[model samples]
Target: MFKSGFVSIVGRPNVGKSTLMNYIMGEKLSIVSNKPQTTRNNIQTIKTTDDYQMVFVDTPGIHKPKHKLGEYMVNSAKDSTKDVDLILFLTNPDGELGKGDSFILESLKGKQCPIFLVLNKVDEFTQDKVAETLSKYSKAFEFDEIIPISAIKGKNVDTLLKLMVDKLPEGPKYYPDDMITDVQERFVVSEIVREKALRCLRDEVPHGIAVDIIRMKKNEKGIYHIEADIICEKDSHKGIIIGKNGAVLKKIGETSRYELERFLRTKVMLKLWVKVRKEWRDNNNLLKELGYKNVK
Candidate 1:
């Protein structure tokens, strides 16, 4: 029998939701950073085999909104719980159930599907602490299953996969075997540039920045040429991104070009420019143009 279904991985910021999805998919489909609100979209990563196909939806971390963009991200995370076969609610063993997690659990309490309280980053804690955390959360919401595993270390993750497959319903494959993600090439390319920026910049600049792909084409000699604009919110921030003598922008470009070459499997000629769009995060039209549209 063929089993297939969608599983949403939802959690607070920096709780390893993207890490778990990347580990499960065996590829870097969703970009990762230690910063909050790093993931801005509900990216679907497909894992297909002869027996089963699991669609893992990596959502933005649910948090209180401070702007229209923040509201969209939180709503995007909430919408995933309503329509999935199961929820691998990823969280760290923070010793106690905090407000951020409690809010998410209260919402999941109304959902129909099974929910797995997958405690990630188990390698960072002691066995007793992990056990204590499992016990504490078990009383809060009556989750379907509770397992502790380190996503980065592949510990007990195979068992997690087994439990997920057992819980899935029998259905047909939703995507072709060769396909691994639901996003287009342009979206992934833009994300790659954004990921590099997030890694290089400080706390304030990364969240206010966006990458716009202005041009992407290939030449006859098997080389890909790409051009993008790194959008910031203020003139000073533009200077920060560009840096003195263009050092920081060069760093972002070089790292992005390396990743693009790997993803596209060809030589990459990348061009980057920094531009300011004051408070673009709060601008509704600009938000939609930057691919933060509300499909819900």
Candidate 2:
């Protein structure tokens, strides 16, 4: 008997949702950065085995919205809780019993599927702190299982995976074995550029920027030639993205090309340009164009 299901990993921004998924899938399907809100969409990563399959949905972090894009992200996260076998509420010790955690827990209340309170980053805290968090959340909500893990260190992740597989009912393999992700190659390439920008740009500038892939074509030599524009909200931010004498922009392109090469398994000749898109977050049309569509 084979079991298959979708598991939604939900949490506050920067709580290691994408990190945990990347660790479990052993593939960097979602981009990771020090910045919060780095993942803007629900990325489904398939982990298939002879006994079971887990389609892990790495949802955007749940946060208070300041713009249309933010609203769409939060809604997308909420929608992921539906029609899934389990939910992993990933959190760290510092956020234990905090208002942000409380808000997420409240929204998760009465979910039909079993909810797992996954306490991440346990390596950063003491055993007592982990116990304290577990005790508090156990009273707050009756979770199906409570597990602590260090996603970066690969601690107890195997146990988490086993438990998740056990919770799933017998079902069919929804995707082919060779496929690792649900998103298209173009979307993944665009996210690679955005990830580099998020890592290199200033804190404020990263959030104001979006990446648009203008063209991507594969030549006969199996080399990918791609063109893209990095959209920012202000002239000053554009300068920051471009950096001194285009040094920062150059770095972003080189790193992005390296990542694309690894992901696509081909040489990537990437070209980048920075453009201004003032308040694009609030513009619904631009938001949709940037892939933040309404969840329905």
Candidate 3:
């Protein structure tokens, strides 16, 4: 029988939800960083097999909204939980269940779909502590299953997949077997530039920056040439990104080029420019144009 269903990965910020999604999809559909709230939208990745197709919805981390953007992200995450056949509520095994996890569980109280309490990072937890940690979470909700997995180490991930497939309802495949994700190529390029900025910058510089890919083309030499802008809220931020003698911008370009080549499996000539947009995050029109729509 064919089985297809949506599974939402919801959890607190920096709980490795994106990392788990990347590992499951076997590709980097969502950007990963040490920073919290790195994902600001719902990214859908499709995994198709001979008899089952799982559409994994990788949502933004659940957090208290500090701005319009934060609110949008949180709402997107919560929205993904509703109407799904299964919800993978992930938590860090090394950390205690805090107010954030409580808040997410509280919100899912009456949801009809089955919930799976996924204790990620179990490799960091000792065998003795694992049972206690599992017991602590088991009391909070009547989860359909309690799975302890190490997403980074790929431990018990196959078991998790088998369980998820078993729970999936029988239906036709929503996408072809070779299809990977729902995000467009331009979005991928923009995210690649942003990922590079996040890796290179410190403090609040990465948070203040947004990337847009203006042009992309393949030359006669079969090399991909791309032009993108790294936008900041102020001229001072622009200066920081450009650095003295254009050193920082060059570093960003080189790093992004390497990642793009690895992802696209081809050579890439990346050109980056910094521009001051002056608090563009609060501008609804600009945010919508940049694909950051409010989730209401």
Q: Give the higher-lDDT candidate: 2 or 3.
A: 2
Query: What TM-score does model 1 achieve against the real structure?
Result: 0.97
TM-score per model over all chains: 0.97, 0.97, 0.94
lDDT per residue as tens, model 1, 24-67: 88999999988888999999999999999999999999999878
Misplaced by over 4 Å in model 1 are none
State the displacement of the C-alpha of residue 271, model 2, in Å, after optimal TM-score superposition: 0.8
Query: In candidate 3, what are the lDDT values of residues 110-147, reduced to their tens digit?
Result: 98988999898888888767787677788878899989
- Candidate 3: where are CA atoms >4 Å away? 127-129, 294-296
What value does the lDDT take at residue 192 in candidate 2?
A: 93
Candidates in order: C-alpha RMSD to true structure: 1.2, 1.2, 1.7
Colliding residue pairs in candidate 2: none
Clashing residue pairs in candidate 3 (N, C-alpha, C atoms within 3 angstroms) = none
- List the lowest-lDDT window of 10 residues for candidate 2: 287-296
User: What tens digits encode model 2's per-residue C-alpha lDDT throughout 1-296?
Assistant: 99999999999999899999999988888999989999999998999999988999999999898888888888988889998999999998653698888999999988899999899999899988999988888999999999999999989999999899889999999999988898999999999999999999888898788999999999999999999999999999999999999999999999999999999999989999999989998998888888777722
